[model samples]
Target: MKKMFKLQWLSVLMLAFVLVGCGAKEDTNKETVSKEDQQVEKTSYKVKDDRGVEVEFNAVPKTIVSLQPSNTEILFALGVGDKIVGATEFDTYPEEAKKIERVSSSTTFDSERILALKPDVVIAYTTGGDDENLNALKVLEDAGIKVFAIKSATSFDDVYGDIQQVASVMGIEDKGEKLNEDIKAKIAEVQAKVKDVKAKNVYLEISPKPDIYTTGSGTFQQEILNAANVKNVFADLKSWPKVSEEDVIAKNPEVILTTVNYTENPAAEILARDGWNSITAIQNKAVYFIDPDISNRPGPRIGEAVELIAKAVYPELFK
Candidate 1:
């Protein structure tokens, strides 16, 4: 009777082992199917950029070269940092960007260096690429490398489109959509915080006194100032207009904001401007400095820039 009981116990153990083995096989099969589905989901199509250049893709790119810092920022934001083989010297965000090879910066692009990298796609922009050497992009195109020109954005909506363009080329439009929504949400949050406050006339000094340069209506800096409920004293002007001290004094801006970092202390320098004792901004000590990257670099951090400007304009509301 004892021997029969032992045999029954062994049979139960064998059945349990078989059930566990079947469960493990089921999980393995599910993983294989998931991978197969992912492979099957990828599709290819034609895309045209701001420059009217079209490129066809067979699949997602393996390597990329970004000449524009804003475009580079967008590429990394969309989870394509691993694919970026080269970027400009100014591409300093996400911390991982500094690890990539520098192929372009300011007004320079190295064709030989870019050729050595053999990137599948290259991102350039009209505002930054409008130079004699920019034709080097054609040399890369002749060699079967795809080139896409990012648009010269004058407003925040244009920036959203820029992100979508990069995301689509990388086959990640959903990520772009999600990112733009987040940006829009953050902008709306800043707007709500300062919506009821009185708008202040602001003078945006992009350069030092004497040869002072400032942004006007059709620029990203002006859009941010407007969102913060601050009026640009140069709104009637267009592009980066050079303003005379006489005209600025006549307009009499309440707040003086500078993005110029070439000097050690921009606000202090503003305070020491010649013949400005009666001006409201200098008199009330409303001179503030903004980081050029936050205001000038058009990318995913624009909402942060807008918020920073808003705080500078109305610290009481933000605080």
Candidate 2:
């Protein structure tokens, strides 16, 4: 009977060892899972927008809404176009943005439609004041949606920052850097070609006719003019300024670049202006019409805008 008891004890001891081994294996697996969870938790998405507002995301946004056309262009350039579920009525680039649901207009925001769309994030813009749109966006923010507002860009660096901000929000910072580099390289190439060429005095007309408007210093258009090795005749002025025809004719710019597209033929209209026969640009037929969409937007296509301006100003050199 004592021998039998010893054998049973040995069997029990082996079973206890097996159970302990299994428990240790199970505990190791739990530890492995815990580490993986911790690693995922460590991955974070955060960006400070041009407004200096810190935006955080729980994960890469699956649905995005771009309130500005420039933001739409940047998102498409970043290859996150599919994620854009909503955009402004003015977003007409990439041909696909037009198909997206329009949630806002130049002067109106459809908060109800945007809320119904249930976007993961909304990309907005501000002109550095108490924007009424911010009040509308606040509703989205209260609804647990992320709103990132980018300030209006006044320089190429600002444009780059805007791109990086959008990219960071989309979790694609590498692509944003590459896009900015590509733009810089293209601009550099054009700059090198024009470095030896004499800089031309230019009058860039943002609007034409009775009331004329042009960009001056402290504006992105001025930067584009600078990159093209051209001088804005209105650079002495700050921001966008309304100038009289008398002032423009007096400036007598060597090249007149107009981004006025509301009319059928902006160049023709400029040429037909009364009492403007003495202007050098009109005399030399140097009034070139720039695509307002491209030139005006502070987005990925700014390089193209610079090249267009350069080509218009110095056709011989670019060719």
Measured against the true structure, the TM-scores of the candidates, in listed sequence, are: 0.84, 0.85
Task: State candidate 2's TM-score.
Answer: 0.85
In Å, residue 143's CA in model 2 sits off its true spot by 1.5
- Give the top-scoring candidate (lDDT): 2
Encode model 1's per-residue lDDT on 1-319: one tens digit a residue.
1110011111221111110000000001111112431321234555677656666666667899987677777888787787899987777887999998987645457777777888888876653334333465677787778887665666787788888787767666668889999999999999999999889999988877668888788777888998888999999999778889888888899999988777889999988988887889999999999987777777888899899899988989976
The models' CA-based lDDT, in order, is 0.73, 0.75
Candidate 2 — what's its lDDT?
Answer: 0.75
Task: In candidate 1, list every pair of residues with a backbone clash.
Answer: none
Candidate 2 stretches greater than 4 Å from native: 1-44
Model 2: colliding residue pairs: none
Model 1 alpha-carbon miss at residue 174, Å: 0.5
Error of 1 at 187 (Å): 0.4
TM-score of 1: 0.84
lDDT of 2 at 166: 77
lDDT of 1: 0.73
